[model samples]
Target: SLGQFAISENGGIALAQISNHYLGNFGMIILALIVIIACLKTTVGLMSAFSETFVELFPKKEYRFYLLIVSILPCIFANIGLTKIIELSVPVLMFLYPLALILILLALLSPLFKHSRLVYQITTAFTLLAAIIDGLNALPASLHTITFISVIINFAKDFLPFFSLGMGWILPSVLGFIIGCLCQITITVYKNKKSSTLS
Candidate 1:
């Protein structure tokens, strides 16, 4: 049973424990091999993408240099252990996930909005603000005691709808989108009127 496996800071241990219990040493070996292959493929893909992007952005830097930096940094950071890595990543993931979701939503609704950059920018700006607050809230408990962060968290909880449920960004994002659509309509109308007057 899953409950029989001891819990640890590294959640992956449970899977290993389960496999080992069910199938003995061979199962553990196979699981480890699978994990290694998975990690290797992911690392390679990420490194290649990062290196290519950096090379384009900074043409002076060679791809090899970027690859080396990415490789070395992760190697160094990996020494911190899985628990620490997860702890550091949680807040960052919290911050990015909402912005990513909002961008995807905007893309899907682009036809209705005529793919207006103004609409995307305004909505993204609002979502970014809320995402920042959520990220701060997700920070380590020790950091929560900081006066400014605590104040911000308290303020969000008091006013932002669904904040306690971690969906506070929803209302603001909707409002921004509506406002963006209105601005786009008003600008389009003004442009048409000016063109008509000139003709």
Candidate 2:
């Protein structure tokens, strides 16, 4: 139990190594961005392709074309990329109440054990501890900002209807997937056929 809680010297060294690996090559960031963009394109292409094939195997959705358009944003959550995006265009997300509620449900249910309060409690506790520690540790040198202001972005908005689930990187991707399925079927079929005939 003690060992489980202890932060080993080896662990610290490994973490430092990992950090260095990430922050080391300046050119690697560009290479990685290129690779990430390539992979996302491949992923979407494959998904659209497989979806096309699967319809022959199984039943197809009525609204597949509209949904694909909503999922155009490239899937990336690296802090480096995110900071760049924030500097470029910090989206003020506003949605209709129904859409907002749907996003909330998509986030909360999340394919995990549905309605499991214990799991939620444990997850929340871990999240809270990490967030609070980040706040405290980042406070000393950046001592100008008081603790009160730090609390807003720190706390969870699990109960709030119109909430920003900032801790998650996957949610936007998943939401994109869902909204894709909901909106983009007809156009996708035409484009799929046109491209298929050419290929």
Candidate 3:
């Protein structure tokens, strides 16, 4: 079924093909409806949130204006074809994934770290640098040919572990967290010693 369709052309084509093959016309219709309904709700929610946030951030712009812009941009981009949109989004997603993962980890370990701002800042700073490198590495081969990008990629390949496997951010994030913890401890000790000496 999927063999008949070019799945690479559109992300949904393969899903549609599979549904049509196993359950015929009815399955296709159901799948279409499900996708439409899911997308509709998601779009509405995102647009509302985006417009509201922008309106607050830039009070000169009205909510409706922001909403209109957000709505129009997606429509224009959608015309570019799903494959192209996905190609553009991959690097962005790669850049964000590590940052998001680090945040989640920090939240989970907040109790142990005593919710120290230093830990969060240091860890995120290190992770951000590595994530940027990862995103650059994920860029198209043509972009990778650019001198600076190629140099960065080569440096990461030489010095960063698991970079080839796309797990390059792991070591940096851990090291940052450890360094942050040490800094926090040192600060606390210094403050305590200073207070004792003063007393």
Best by lDDT: 3
Q: Which runs in model 2 stand beyond 4 Å of their true positions?
A: 1-38, 45-62, 65-68, 71-83, 86-120, 132-147, 150-199
lDDT of 2 by residue, 1-199 (tens): 2333445344433444444456666545655676579788887777677667655565655336423533443443334354355433323222122234444654677554444444344444433433443334233334426566445434434322223433332343344444444334444678899999999
lDDT of all the models against the reference?
Answer: 0.91, 0.45, 0.93
What's the distance in Å from true for residue 154, model 2?
12
Candidate 3 segments exceeding 4 Å error:
1-10
Least lDDT summed over 10 consecutive residues: which range in candidate 1?
Answer: 1-10
Q: TM-scores across all candidates?
A: 0.92, 0.23, 0.91
Winner by lDDT between candidate 3 and candidate 2: 3
Question: How far is 48's C-alpha from truth in model 2 (Å)?
Answer: 6.0
Once all C-alphas are superposed, what RMSD does model 3 give against the true structure?
1.9
> Model 1, 1-199: lDDT tens per residue?
5478556667677777888888999999999999999899999999999999999999998999999999999889989988899999988988998899999999999999899999999999999999999899889999999999999999999989988877778988998899999999999999999999999
What is the C-alpha local distance difference test score of candidate 3?
Answer: 0.93
* Each prediction's number of clashing residue pairs: 0, 11, 0
